[model samples]
Target: MDMSMVWRQWLTRHDRVRDALPAVPLIVIAVAATAVGNSAWHEPHWDKVVWTALSCVPLVVRSRWPLQVALFTLAGDLTLMTVVSHTSPTPAACLVAVYTLALLGDRRTAWIVGFVAAVTIAGVYSATHADSVVGGAGLVRFDFALGATVLGRTVRSRRDNLAAAKARAERAERTREEEARRRVTEERVRIARDLHDIVAHHITLVNAQAGVAHHLMRDNPEQAYQALAHIKDNSRAALDELRATVGLLRQPDDTPGSRAPVPRLSDLDNLADGFRASGLDVRVTRTGTPSPVASSTELTAYRIVQEALTNTHKHGSATRAAVVVDYGAKGLRVTVTDDGRPGVPKGAGTGHGLIGMHERAAAVGGTVSAGPRAEGGFQVVAELPISPRSRLTPA
Candidate 1:
């Protein structure tokens, strides 16, 4: 419809022809220079015309088969000079072919071809210089061939560097995506652990308290009422903790309910009290003054104790469980143990709980050891580091 638009469409549709556009100017220059040379030297005009045409025509397909085109053009030029004593612009066409060969061919092949072409042209010129009109220009032709080869080599080196840079960029992007996936997987696991700890701890108490309420409904009405009240309280607490854990999956702006505070080391006493109400005797011991720690670290400690106690209550035949926290000079150490039979409990589940504990501790550069104790029970111990700067600084 428009001139520029029509021109653009034509160029896009004829990519091969467009790539050959550069050869048009070289062909014109070669023909013109040859015509001028023949007139200056009083050479046979028709013979010069034929020689120029043969030398320049090969450049038309130079881009397709650069080395072959170069050799063909070089052969025609050498024949013209030696057989006809012609002085023409055929050397320019050969130079263009040599450049294309160096740029497109393999490095070793280009080097070999360039050397042979240079030597052949120089040898032919020396053998024919005595009778040839173009004999004096032999050195210039040799220089043109060498210069084109250097230029082509430089361009090839630049293209190689650019390709390497692009490959590195793609590799870096892949690495970033893999790292993001790893983080997401880790977050999902942490959420699952939190869910397990919250649900198991409260539900166990609810079941025990329900059993008590049912057993004492007639004989001890007051105690039955108290057990029912404990059930309601435990259920509400469970719901609140569940809401808090689920909130972590929500986007910051999606406010069905805001995130509730996570359970901390301070919450362990209340956590143990719930187990006590469920009829398991839970004792907590502190060895040193509580040190300041990261909120995540505090939550991890609480969950470790919570999961350990849940395992004892749910999986072991333990009547009593102990939780010990020691704020050692290096870090905080937590130990949970139970005086239960050294065997699996009634309804023991997939061992994800123990694995979850170890994963949690490892995340914050801590270590946990859990196994059957030599005495007569199960024991879990975890040690977490406390950064001195974080202890002194507020978050």
Candidate 2:
């Protein structure tokens, strides 16, 4: 109902222009024919006046039924030639009709229709023409016939061009859509992989702790309570990170009642705390100036840290882990390294943990490389570009 809304609707929909073809050519032909008819006759009366009027009827369904219109025009011209022998603008109408038919039909059909109209017009002029049909009437009968044929073909050609343009536009749109969908799908897979790496580790920890509790409950009550506490903390941390990682699927601006917030660069601290509570000795450090980056980039950074910590918890047989967040003018760098020992019982080398870290880093124009430290343990290094967050947030 609103003007802007209507404009938006039209802008989004491309079919309107293509569908208006029937009216444009028909209107032009009508106006031209009327001018030519009046100029040719001194008086208001002419046999073609009736024929011309009849031509108007076919325009109603010109686009929906081009073939039928072409046939009707041909028949109308012939009937006019017979009935209004003394007053037909036989040359003009014949050619115009040919052009119309050609425009509305396919290349081959248009040609055939044009040829028929040409021949029919030429025959009528040659045999039953007025004494003044050509020389006195200044009638270029063949030219008119040919012109009409050409007009129909040209309209059809233009229509084809328009259709092709539409197709290309549609194809471009489809490609954009598919590309977006693919990226989202990839993000989902990355989330799944992160959940696998992080939550799986915690679940593993929970299972391990549960076993320790069961074994120690009979032998030592205090040790059993500590192990049970570890399981609870680990389980809760797993739930929180899982919620944040999967929250990407949610619509951020969804109407009113929605599920969760889309995690941004700001959510990195929460991510860190969850890992810390999961029984990893994770100390987050920062240096240099931090620039704002896109939401996508922020999410990547968060996931990288999260995955890195999960790796440490899973594989590090050592006790402490450190994360250095460096914000430079051009980009951000995160180095997550542990002395490869969680003080706990497990080791962290094999799985999608590192793979997920690399993916998240690469997504935001960053790189991740992880391996056993030359000194003793494992280290993961990631660097990402910082696109100012202010530029990315919606106004």
Candidate 3:
């Protein structure tokens, strides 16, 4: 859209038009100077005009064959000086050719050609004009040739630097895009784990309570009503937790309090009560003074406990389970043990529950170990740092 950029684009699309631009002015100046000189001498110099035009015409292709064009123009200049005894002070066409060579050719070749052109032109002009080698027209023409070479090299360097900078910008943009995609993938995995834990835990309890209500309905109507009430409570709890978990995907600009509060260690008692309602005896004990921790660390600790108890309720033949929490100087240690026979084989079912617990622990720089106890039960123990070096924010 910029005017200068548009002009450059037009020029680039028409190579012959761009290349012929330099020749137009060079031809005009040389022909005009030749006519003026001939008029002053009271004679016609048609040969000088023709040769000058001939020399300037090769500039149209200077970019394509710079060395050949330079040589051709040099021959024309030498011919006008030696054979015709007519010399132009400027030698415009020859200088243009040398500049084109330096601009397009390799550095070594450009310097070699430039040096030869300067010395040869200056030497021949000096010899024909009988001028001093150091302080004369010859020296001035030599300087002009050197100046053209330097100018051409400078332009070439600037172009190369611009090209490199453009490449670096493009690469940086691609890196940012890849990083964004990686973060999105990590967030999706975290969300999936949360949804699984929420749905699985509540659904397992609902199934247990529904069976109790069905069996008691025929003979014990009052107990059946209690079982149905527990089912209603659990289903409602499941819906509320599901809404909170899915609310994590809400827009960031939404009010912070719009989403439900995430679970923490303080909610462990309520979590145990939920299991106890499903006919699993659960007890929780704490040692040492509880200290505040990062929200992410607390969430990790809570999820690990919830997942451990869910597994015990669904798979273990345990009537009683004990949860122990120790707030030590180094970190927080949580242990859940059940006095039940391990009904499920090792590496059983989908295995997502155990895997999710381990992942949550690791995300907060902690560890989880679950196995059958040597004394005859199953236990899940987790050790979590009080202040993790890094943690994944809950989505």
- Candidate with best lDDT: 3
Candidate 3 — what's its lDDT?
Answer: 0.81
Models ranked on lDDT = 3, 1, 2
The sequence of per-residue lDDT tens digits that candidate 2 reaches over residues 207-236 is 767877888898999989988887788777
Task: List the lowest-lDDT window of 10 residues for candidate 1.
Answer: 386-395
Q: Is 1 or 3 the stronger prediction by lDDT?
A: 3
Candidate 3, residues 162-272: lDDT per residue as tens digits?
999999999999999998998888788888888888888889888988888899999999988988898888898778888887787888887767567888889999988
Reference-based lDDT, each prediction = 0.78, 0.65, 0.81
TM-scores for candidates 1 onward, in order: 0.79, 0.54, 0.84
Candidates ranked, most accurate by TM-score first: 3, 1, 2
Q: What digit string (tens of lDDT, one per residue) describes model 1 on residues 152-260?
A: 8889889999999999999999999998898777778778888988888889889999999999999999999999998998999998988888888778788864666
Can you give the lDDT of residue 162 in candidate 2? 97
Q: Which ten residues in a row have the lowest lDDT in candidate 2?
A: 386-395
Candidate 2, lDDT over the whole model: 0.65
Q: What is the lDDT for 273 in model 1?
A: 87
